[model samples]
Target: MRDYPNDQNLQDLQERYHLFAHMDAAIIDAERDKACPEGPLQDLVVGLKANIASIGANWSAGLRHRIAITAQSDAHLTKRLRDHGARILPGLNMDAAALGGGTDNPDLGRTANPHAPDHSAGGSSGGSAAAVATGLCDVAIGTDTLGSIRIPASYCGVFGLKPTFGLIGRSGIVPLAPSLDTVGILTARAGDVWPVLQALAGPDGGDTDSQPAPAQWANQTATPDAQGLRIGIPQQVSTVECTPETLVALASARTTLEQAGAHVETIDMPEWNPAKLRQKAFLMTEAEGAATFAEALGTAGTLPRTVERLLTYGSTLSAAKLVAGMAEIRAARVQLARSFAQVDVLLMPTTPQRAFQADAPAPANQADFTALANAGGVPALAVPIEVAGQALPASVQLVGPAWSEPRLIRLAMVLESAF
Candidate 1:
C-alpha cells in the first residue's frame, strides 16, 4: 500500500476548502490495509462523495445528524477501486441531503471553488470536483442526479463523466432519486477517467441497477476517431439564455469538431424541453428523497429546513401528478433515443453560466441543459473549454445514447486537444 506522509497537508487543504465531510488518519489507515498493489489504480488517491459508503468513515450523505454513523462495509464501487489499487480518502462534504445546486452545507460548510475562492463549486457533488481541482486527490467519486457531477466539473474546470445509467453500480450510494442517481468520476486529466471507470464499472449483484457490459463496450479495443462522426447540437440550446462566454465556447467546440472532419449540425428535437424535463426530474428527486429519508424527516435536527421543506412539498404531490411527471420524463427519453438515431452525439454547454460567487443566489436554470441526460439515462461527459480573457473556464458536454461512454470520452479528448 502507498503511504500518505502528507496527511497534514491534505487535512489543511480540506479545512481551507471544506472539501471533506470527514478526514482522519484512522480512515486512511484502514483503507491502506485493503489496497491492492498490482491493480490499475495502484498509487492513485481517490476521494468519495459523502453518500458513498466506505468502512471506518462517516456515511451521513451530508445530513447533520447522521454524521456519527460509520459505514460497516465499503460501497461496491469503493471496494472495486480498492481492489484495483486506489488509496481511498475520507468521505467528502456535499449539499445537505443532496438537495441544492450550491455546495453550501448548513452543517458541514461550503465547498469553495479552487479556481476562484469567492465562487461556488456546483452542487451535491461539488466537494468531489473541488478536491480533484485542488489536487487533494487524483480522482473523486460523485453521484449525479440531474447534473450534479457535470455542473461541478464545469464550474471547477475539471473532467467529469456521468456514465450510462447502471453502467456503474449504486449498491452503497444513498438514494436521492433512484431513477436518476448515477455514480461517476471526476479527474484532473481526461485520460484518468477511463482507467478509473474500467476499474469500478461492471455487474454487481448487490445493486439492482447494475448491468453487464454491453458487447460494444466489452469488445472496444481502440479509441474512436473524430473523423466523420455525426455531431448534433439541439435547436433548443438556442432558446436557453447563456452567457456570451458559454456561447462562444460552444461555437468553438463545434468548429474544432468540424475541423476534425466530424459532421456538426443543428438538429430539431421538439420533444426534448430542458426546462420542463428538469422540473419533472426535480419532482422525482424530491419525492423519492422524501421516501428515502422518511424516518429522518420526523426527527428535528436530522435535516435542514430547506431540505425539509422540499421533501414536505414532495410528500404533498398527488399520486396522479407523480405518475404524470414520470410519463413526461419517459416521453422525453423516447424523444432523445430517436434523436440519437440521427446523430452519434448531442453537444451543448454543461451549464448556462460560469461559477457564480459563493454568496450569490443559486441559479434556477443551472440544470436546464444537463437534466436531459439524466432523464434519458444516457452518458454525458463534461470537459472544460478555455476561453481567452475569461477569469473562469466555460464547459461543454457530449451526450450520447446509453453505453456510449467510450465515444464520449474519445470525443472529449479531441475537444480537449483543440483548447
Candidate 2:
C-alpha cells in the first residue's frame, strides 16, 4: 500500500502540484495497519480534498482564517475509505469556502493544471483533479456542491463523478450547502470509479440525509458496450453558448457513441432556460451557503473576494425569493424526469468553456450547465474528451435520474472511449 512514494518524496510531489493542504506520514501508516484484509480500494493512494474531514488533517476549506483548523475525528467518507484499505496521502486544495469553479485559493496555493501548468485546475476541487491527472495519486475524493468535482476533472483531463444527493453519506464534511453537497471521486480512468462508490454507499446513522441503496446498486458494470442506449443531446447544449472547442469535443463524443451502437437524438429541454436557472441556482446556493457559514459571517471580510461576495449575496437574498426559487427547482426536477423518460441520459458539455488561465478572473459561465444536476438531485459524470488540436482537455457531462449512478458510469465508459 506504500507503493507510490516515501514521506520525503510525497512532500516534493505536493509542493510540485500544490495538491495537498496538510499531510502526515504517521497517520497514513496507522491507517494502513488497521486496513481490512481485502476491500474495494485496497492499496490505492487516495487524496482527500481538503474540506472533507480526516482526523489529523487540516480541514480548512482553503480560507486563511481557518488554516489552523484540523479535524478531531474522521469524516464518514474517510472512515469508509480507510476500512477499504485506501491510503490517505494528503488532502487537496479547494476554493476559499468552496464557492467557485476555479481552484484559486488564496489561503493554500493555487492548484495548477498538469496539462498546462499556467492554466487553472477546475475547482473548488482543483487539487484533487490535479493530483489524479499528474499521477500524484491513484484516485482522489472530492465534494461537489456545485460542479466542483466535474469542472476540475474536465480541466485536468480526468474523470469525476458526482453521485446522486444522499447516495453517499455526508456526516463528516464541511458543507457549502447541505441541500446540494455530495461526496464524489476523481480518477484516472472510468473503470476505477465503481469500486470506490461501492465502498461508500449506504446509510450512515449520523447523516440525516442518508438514503437506502437499491438492490445490486454497486454491482453495476462499466464495460464499453453501449449498444442500443439512447443518448439525448439537449437542444440547449447542441445549439449555443459552449465554446467552439467544447462544441467540437461534444460533436466528436456524440459521433463516437453513435459508432458504438448508441441511438443519438436531439431533445428539447425548453424548461431548462440556462439564464433563469443560473440565477435561481445562485440565489439558493448562496443563501444556503450563507446560512452554512453563519458563524463566520463576521469574518467574511477575511475570505477571498469571490467567496466573500457569494456569502454576502446569499445572506442578502429575500426569504420569499428563496422559497419561490426552490419551488421552481422542484418543478424543474419533475420536468427533467419527464425528459429522461424518453431518453436514458441527458448530455452536455460540463462547462460552457474550458479552464481559464491561472491569472484570469474565474469565468462566470463556468457552472451554467452543471448546477442543474445539483439542483435536480441527479447523478452526473464528467468524462474527458479530446479536442482535435488542443493540448488541454474538454469534457461533456452525462446526467441520469436519481440513483442512476450505475447507468451513468456505463455511459461514461462508452463516452470516454472516444478519447
Candidate 3:
C-alpha cells in the first residue's frame, strides 16, 4: 500500500533532532550466557528518551529538563526492571524539547528509516521507533502528545500506542504539553506490547491524571468467532492526500478483518477544516509547552531557535482564545465519544501521506491525523498496515471511551494480526 525506503528518504529528514544522542553503548557479541545471572528482564534492553532523567546526568531543572525528568523517573523504573531482570540503556533525544522536529545525530545518522535509510524515522519519538525497528532493543519508551508515538510508529513500520491520557503516569517524562503528554511504548511484535503495558499501566500517585483501567476491561468482549467486529470506516478520509498504495493497503486491511470474521461499516464524521483544527490544536499545545518550559525559557539567555520561536508563539495566545479552544475541544470530545457507541473501533489512514524526505524538516501540518485522540482523552494505537513491495505502515487508530485501553489494544491486535 505505502512504500517509503532508501537513503534519500533518510537524508530528507535529518534537519530536526540529534539522533546520535541516544543509542546502545554496550555491545554484546552474542546472547547472554545461559548460565549467567539473569533477572525479570534479563533478555531485554530498554531505550530511554534523552528527556527522561537518570543518575549522573540527572538534572530535572536544567535547560532541556526532559532528560532529568526521565532519569529521575527511570531510577524507579530501572530498579523495578532490575528487580524483575532488565537493563536500561541510555536515553534518546527528540525534536528539540520534544517538538516533533526529527533528529540530528550523525553517527546513527539522524534516525532515518530502517527499512530505507534515506527516509526519516518519525518524531518526536523518532529515536524510539528507530531503536525498536532496527532490532537494537526489544522495547523502548516514548512520549506522545498528539501523535508523537503513532506518527513515528507509522513511519518506521512498528507498533505504537497512545494510551488513554492519564492511564500511564507522566511524573518522570518531560512536560511537552503536560495536560496532553502521555508516556507510551514501541515494539516489534503486536503482542509484545502487553508485557510492558502490564508493568507500567498503573498509577504512580504523583500524576493526578493516571488511572488504570479495570482488569475486566482488559478482556475484550468482542469475539471474532461469535460475530464480526463492527469497524467504522470514516468517509472523510477518502481523498488525494492518501497515496494510492495507502488507500489500497487500508482497503486490504479492512478486507482482512472481514475475512477474520469482523463486520465493517462506513461512518461519516463532522467534516474538519484541517488548517483551522491544526491551528486550534497548536494553540493548546504551544501554550501548555510554554508553561512547562517556562523555567528553561526564563533563565537561558537564548534557546534553540525552533523551540524559542514555538515558545514565543505559544506565549502570544490570548487567554480568551485559549479558553475558546478548550471549550471547542471539550465539546468535540463529547460528540466523538458518543460516536464511538455505534462502533467497536474507528479506522482511518494514519497520515494519508508517505514518509517525508529524511533531510527535510517535519511537515508543518504533520499532526492532522493524530491529535483528535489527545483532545478526546481516548486510547489510540497505530499498527503497521500493509504498504507496497516494501513495508510502509498506514495507521489505523482505535480509540475507545476513557480508560478503555484494554479493549483498544485487543481490537488493535486483531487488525495487526493480518500483517
Candidate 4:
C-alpha cells in the first residue's frame, strides 16, 4: 500500500496553500470506515472538490452561508471510490459557487498553485489539482463545467481527465450547469487516471445524466497504438492569440504526434468561434446555476456580491436570450460532431496562457478551447507540456467523440511517454 503523507507535511502544505475548504480528523475517520481492504484503490487517498457530496463532510460548494449543509449520504462516485478502498479527504476549496475560472473563493480563500505559490491554481477545481500536484492526495475528484478541471490541471502541471459527458455519474454533485457539469479526475501522473476512471464510471439510476457503457467499451484496452491515428487541429486554433510559450508547446505536441505515426492535419471549423461559443456557454451556466440555486439567492448575505450579481443576471435573462444561448450551444455540439467525422481526435492548447498571478483578474478567454467539449458533450484530456527552458508548464488537450475516453486516454499516454 502507498503510504499517506505524514501528518505534519500534510498540515504544513494545507496551511501554506489553503487546499481544503473543510478537513479534519472526523472527515478522515468517516471515510476510513468505508474503505475495503481488498479493493483496487485500497492504498489511494482521494480529495474531493467542495461541491461533490461525501457523507459527514460539509458540502458548501464554496458558499459561506451553505457551509452548514452536510451531505447525508455519499455521492455515487464517492461510494464507488470507497468500495474500491480509497480514503476520502474533506472538501477542497473552489471558486465561489463554482462560477469562476480561478480558485479564489470569497468564502474559502484561494488555492495556491503547487508549481508557483503566487500564481493561481486554475478554478472551480483548483483545490483538487493542487492537492494532487503537492502529493496531499494520490488523486482528486473535481467537477468540470467549461474547463474547471482541465484549467487547474494545466496550471498545476498534473494530469486531468474530463471524461466523455455522462460517462461518469453525477449524483450528489452540486449542479453548476446541469447540461455541462461533469465529475472528472486529477492525478500527478497520467497513468493513474485510467484505473480510477475504470473504478468510478458506470450508470447510476439516481443520476438521470448517467449513461451506460457501450458494448464496444466493455473489453476495450487502454493501450492504443498511435500509428495511423488521424489528428485534426482546427484552423481557428492557429488564429487564436496564444502566448509564445503556449504556441511553442502546441507545435511541439503536433510534431511529436506526427513523429509517432499519427497523421496531423489542419482542418476548418467554420461554424465554431471559440470566443463566441464560450460566451454562450457562460450564459448557459449562469442561467442554469441561477435556477439551481434559486432558493439560496433569496436569502441576502448568503452569497458574495459577485456571485449574487452573476446569478441575478442569469435569473433576469429574457426567455428569448436563454433560448438563443441554448440554440448556439446546440450548434457548437453539431459542429464538434462534424469535426469528429474527419479525425479520431482534436488536439489543441488547453488554455491560451500559463498560470497568472492569483491576485490578477481572470482572463475572459480562459475557456476558449475547452468549452466546446462540454457544449458538444465530448471527452477531453488535459496534459502538461514540459518546455525546455520554461519554468511554468504549458498544456494541451485531446478531444474525442462522446464515449471516446479510452481512445483519448490511450493517445494521452503516448504523449505522456514521449514527454
Alpha-carbon local distance difference test for all models: 0.88, 0.83, 0.65, 0.87
Report backbone clashes per prediction: 0, 0, 53, 0
Model 1: per-residue Cα lDDT over 1-419, one tens digit each: 22442768777887789898767677776665664577878878888999999887899888888888888998999889888878887688799877888889988889999988899999989999999988878999999999999999999999999998898998987889888898999998887788888888888888888887776575553253688899999999988889999999999999999998899999999987888888888999999988988898888666899999999889889999899789879988999989999999999999999999999998989999889999899999999999898779999999999988878888888888888
| lDDT by residue (tens digit), candidate 4, 34-147 | 536667788798889999899888999998887889999989999898888888886899998899988988877899998889999999899999999888899999999999
Model 1 segments beyond 4 Å from truth? 1-5, 29-35, 219-224
lDDT for each residue of candidate 2 in 121-233, tens digit (9 for 90 to 100): 98989999998998878889999977899999999999999998888889888888888888899999898888888888988888898997788777777677678989898
* Model 1 local distance difference test score: 0.88
- Higher-TM-score candidate of 2 and 4: 4
For candidate 4, the TM-score is 0.97
**Candidate 2, after superposition: displacement of residue 48 in Å?**
0.4
| Stretches of candidate 4 exceeding 4 Å from the true structure | 29-35
Give the Cα RMSD of candidate 4: 1.4
| Count of backbone collisions within predicted model 2 | 0
lDDT of 3 by residue, 12-95 (tens): 332343343533222111112223236445546666665665444332221343332323334444344445555554455466
Alpha-carbon RMSD, candidate 1? 1.7
Positional deviation of 180 in candidate 1, in angstroms?
0.9
